[model samples]
Target: MDPVRTGGLRVVRAAVVLCVRAAPGTVALSFVMMFVGGVTPVGLAWSTKLLLDGITAGDPAGRNAGVAGLVVLGVLTALLSHVRRYCDQELSRRVKVRTQIELFTAVSAYQGLAEIEDSAFHDRLRIARDASEFAPVQIMSSLLTLASSVITLAGFGYTLLRASPWLAGLVLLSALPTLRAQIRLARRHGEMIVRASPFWRRQAFYAALLLDPRAAKEIRLFGLAGNLRTRMAREIHAGQAEERAQDRETLRVDLGLAAMTSVLSGAALAYLAARIAAGHGTAGDLVVLIAALAATQTALTSAVLDVATTGELITTFGHYIDLTSRARPQPRPVAELAALTGEIAFHDVWFRYAPGQEWVLRGLDLVIPRGRSVALVGENGAGKSTIVKLLCGFYAPVRGRITWDGVDLADIEPLELRRRIRATFQDFMTYELSAADNIEVGDIGGGRGRADLAAAADWAGIGETLAGLPRGYDTLLSRTFSDSAGDGGHEPTPGVVLSGGQWQRLALARAVLRTSADLLILDEPSSGLDVRAEHEIHRRLSELRRGRTSLLISHRLNTVRDADTIVVLRDGVVAERGDHAALMAAGGVYAGLFRLQAAGFADETVPR
Candidate 1:
């Protein structure tokens, strides 16, 4: 099929399917109502002609019956109009909810993190989301409106043809220009929206920064609010300026079309008046001719506009289809992953986030032995977090392989592989959920009980802090909502926000909750804590790491001093590897960083 026809079929199929699934009875009834409503205008016009002829012929009974018929048709049309409006509103609501669910499901089904990291993907995803929000309703509405307008136009077209074929042809031809203009405008509008999506997203981000509580402190401290707001306003103005330019073109086209339509209607009206004045046509014929001409023009305009609008909606809906239909890499069929037994090894690994980008991990060889704590120490941009992502199966190496025991990671299902590993990253999310719920999310498959929750909290040294909250484990951990608001609506209560250290401890507690995982990775887990808190956390972590394979990534050298093995990374390659004592004795990159940090602490202790 032609691509345009294929896309149009897809849009129509989706609209029909959604309408029927959302509210089948309402959709059927809406069609009936709109059909009746469409034909009623011609019926009323004919009745009016009859009434005028009855008066002219001086027949009281004929006039009375015509009057009654016209009144009945008008009332029926109004009734159908109201019922159809109600049905459309209900259909729109249902379609909106259903589309949102499908869109979210499609987004969640994506298996790789690479697309999420790409700005172009973000732009497309944002447009898909926006399109899904209203495209279903717009498509259904436009389709139905087109159907009704076509019916109305056909009915009035026949009446005008019988009165004067020339006038009817002129009216039809005038609609051609309007239709062409509307279609062009619709294409331009869609293109502009796609081009402006990134700017709109940036504007939203800046606006969010002004409102975000986390950014509020920094924004005020640095006096960045004014600058950020100005940038946001500038983006909005730029977007508006683009829209205004499009609107100007649209205005010019519409005005020109309107002039043509006015000329056609005026010529039709003058011809009708001349026929009636010369006794060539009855006043009733003039009335009927005038009504048909006016209705034909109106219906043609509406049908053409509906076609243009539907075309635009179909184009937008194409984005949603494209996103949901994207091919994801299929995980190979393989045996279920077995529990880790010996070690996890990276052999000559080389990887980057995208093709042509600089390698984030290059020819890296490392081993994380079973039942041992291994620490990775590195400077910024040393691929520390990238290693964690690779280990967790978020990305596959562009070259080389990672293996658990003797089994290649590439052969293991990503989901199955993830089932045996857990990690907390430097940029861990603080979910706006209850304290217990946040911790529970870590090991949802484990069926963690109250004892397990408490044990995890205690291990992370956050039990005391959680116990003092307004609702203990059930306390809302975010200020986004009131405490009682999310707890089944018992009563409203103010939510409390945790301190930075407290939030980090909660994150640690979340990781600790996943007790069954064979490998536990902590990437800068204690970075947010104070000196005393960091010491206590590492001490607790040391106890937790006793017989489990774990990887620790941290800048603070002291925290990793007790690790069985320490690997220092530099420029995407392993620079050195040994126990803390051996690395320090070697006086390499690790030793230099340790000495620098030690010097800062030593100066602080000199009675400042």
Candidate 2:
């Protein structure tokens, strides 16, 4: 089998297994109901003939029994149909939830944290995210319907054979092309969908802008609603057009097939009716044959539809196969990493974001002494943040290994290294969670429970902030789910929002939630704060660094003038390294930027 087809088959089979596993009893119930329901359909067709024969002859003994049998068959079929629907519901619900849980967990485990900047990975993530919803379960249900429909068609054909073998054969032949046409349509539909992936997401983003509180404010301020909607409609139209074109071809093919099936069915009915009129068959037999053939056509059409639909859905999941196959996390050996200390040394380290990209850090050598505060100042895109990521173990060096107290960093376990360190990046996230949960998110292990979050927040300067919230730290940070509608729609209630500086403070607090870490990294920790807040945070940072080593990356030269050591980075290499005064005498990259910043406040204070 071709790879894509094989993958699609595998996905469908896996979904089927999940459906079966979710509610075994329901699966059994569904099978039983379908079998019984099919039997009742056949019985009803036969009973109708018998009832008609007795009525025509006016024989009360046979008439009563035939009428009662017809009624019983009708009631049985209705009850069986109900049971089948209930079972299908149960199976669908369970499979949907379980597939979502697994897909969610799989995406969570997707590796290559360092490759997060890769756009290709983002596209793959998109598929995995869509897969995490209810698609898997829907495909499974479609497949089960296909199977039951096939069984029903077989029963209908068997009943027809008892009346006229030639009629049954002709009906089967006429209906066969319907399945082929549906299969072609499914492939075309799936292809159109995959091609429209980017368009769909873009439409969704523009659509999202109409509803989001923050985006809504700016959009209305700019009077962009009409423009945004107009753009959205264009993309939507393009996608719809692609779909219509695909269906237009299928429509033609299906119409021809449907016409053929109808002609054959009509011809069969006429032939059977003529035979009954010619005294070759009784009226009762004629009615039974007619009903059976009609039911047979319905069952065959249903079977064909289910097969194509389930196949198409399974094909859609193939989009995720490449990403999911390689998404497994890298193994980490922890026992050897437990001996790590804060001493970090980068030796002849070379790095690149991608294979063909320029090296961000080339042949770099640096070190941070244990229990000391140090700063790295560099121009934008000059590999300042890259170094921090390397130290934090988000990425391993392309050429050299980072050492932790002398052991090669790569040899140490990633989890162990991460547990022993924390960092607050310049572009830190402002989580839409409670102020308490926000800070506690820094050290999830310790961030949970009451005492730990409080201690971390108190140390990071979030105590007063939380106390001021409407519901204190328990309040949700989003307005969407906060004021939920009683009927499961939008509640439209707003939640407490925070200032930029306040949010930055909370991010910092979250980062240092685990004070026991051997190393702590602060990258532009005071970026958005006012002078007083900045000074206060610096004071807190200095206090927090006691007995713990730290690396501070900042462009604000004034903040780290008193650092134990200041290194200047330029053009992917360290340009100058020394104490602030020594760097000033050298007048290198760090000194120049520092002096320029000092010139802004020259009259207030001067670095000696």
Q: What's the lDDT for all of these models?
A: 0.85, 0.76
TM-score of each: 0.93, 0.90
Of the candidates shown, which would achieve the greatest lDDT relative to the real structure? 1
Per-residue CA lDDT of candidate 1, range 1-608, in tens? 11133477787687678778988888888788778868888888888888998999998887887899899997897777788779878988887788788777777766568867878878877887898878877787777888888888888899888877887888898888789889989988887877788889889999998999889899999999999999999999888888899889989988988888888789888988988898977788888888888899999999899889987877777777777655344666665877788999999999998889999999999999999999999989999999998888878899999999978888887778778887777998888888888888888868899788888888888888888898888888877677765455568777779888888998898898877789999999999999898989989889988788999999999999999999999989999999988998999999999999999878765555
- TM-score quality measure for candidate 1: 0.93
Per-candidate clashes, comma-separated = 0, 1
The model with the greatest TM-score is 1
lDDT of each residue in 1-608, candidate 2, tens digit only: 12254466677766667667887788777667656655666777767777788889988867887889888887886777677677767776786677566655666664336446655455545654575355566676566566666766776688778677887888888666788888888887877767676677778889998988768878999999999999999989887888888878887888887888888888888898898898878888887778778888887888788778876776666655444555566776545465345578999999998789899998999998887778889888889899987876778899977888888878766667778888898998877776777877787766277777776667767777777776667766776657343344534456778888888888887887776677889999999999998999998887776556878888888777768889888888888889889989987777779878878887676569
Model 2: residues with Cα > 4 Å off, grouped in runs: 1-6, 57-61, 114-132, 222-226, 320-326, 406-413, 447-449, 483-494, 603-608
Candidate 2, position 183, lDDT: 84
